[model samples]
Target: MDTETLSDHLVELAYGPKELYVDNTYRRILDSRYTEIVGFDFFCALDDAIETALIDWWLSDDAFWGEVKAFEHWQDEVEDGMAWELMDVWETWYGADGHVKIRKASEREKVSYDKAMKKLLCEHEKKKVSIEAEAVRIGL
Candidate 1:
């Protein structure tokens, strides 16, 4: 799927804001390597808009896809030694899930992954603070 094809499909798609978010992600995925939705054969054949739409319908009611932005955040703490990786992933995450309810990836699996990553990030942040406090108290 090229940019022109994605734009055309977006224009024709009958998606609400939420669905549009999913569609937007799907568009990027189409532009990526895994053009097909794995199980489907013709749903990713470059010009098969209908096929793409069909796959979209199949994934219309995902609960996990809604957690992308809510769970992922940009932690821009210069002291944390993050020059770019954190920023880069976060920026990409925002661009993909920002203006659209764009759907891509499997909701079943991705929701869990996103949730776990968020949880771990929070825990790591808390640990960092606790370690700093300990160091300060010990005059180290």
Candidate 2:
């Protein structure tokens, strides 16, 4: 099938059952050349596309903020807990010598982590825009 037709079908499947989407894609689009070019099976591609679309939809719709907010809250808690645990281990394992090492390591990690988080958010925003544009382009 053509890209436009496949995209249209995917958009339609986005509004329906995931299993049906996977099954349909597998039966209609899963072939040797397609798999070789895509580097994955039909279900994996469909799943990723559906997930991206769902995330974009959720972020665009105001009502889904509750789930997103909860996820952010959980991430914050986990980050705080990890920091505490690292400090606790550093103090317990090597009292004075580990202090400098821990500080340096923490500083390095903080910089790297900040960069990674920033990059991830930027990528996500870009992906959201791309998905939205693709949907609009296909007149979905």
Give candidate 1 misplaced runs (Cα > 4 Å).
1-105
lDDT of 2 by residue, 25-95 (tens): 43444566664323235566667777676656743455555544555465566556656655555554343
Candidate RMSDs in Å, in order, are: 23.3, 16.5
lDDT score for candidate 1 against the true structure: 0.47
Q: How much lDDT does each candidate structure score?
A: 0.47, 0.55
Cand. 2 Cα-lDDT: 0.55
Worst 10 residues of 2 by lDDT: 34-43
Q: Write the per-residue lDDT of candidate 1 for residues 1-140, one digit (tens) a residue.
A: 34696456455553443344445543434545566443223333433665455446532325432332222222224235443544444444343665666436566656765775576577668756865664454322
After superposition, the stretches of candidate 2 with alpha carbons farther than 4 Å from their true spots are: 1-57, 97-140
Give the TM-score comparing model 1 with the true structure, all chains together: 0.25
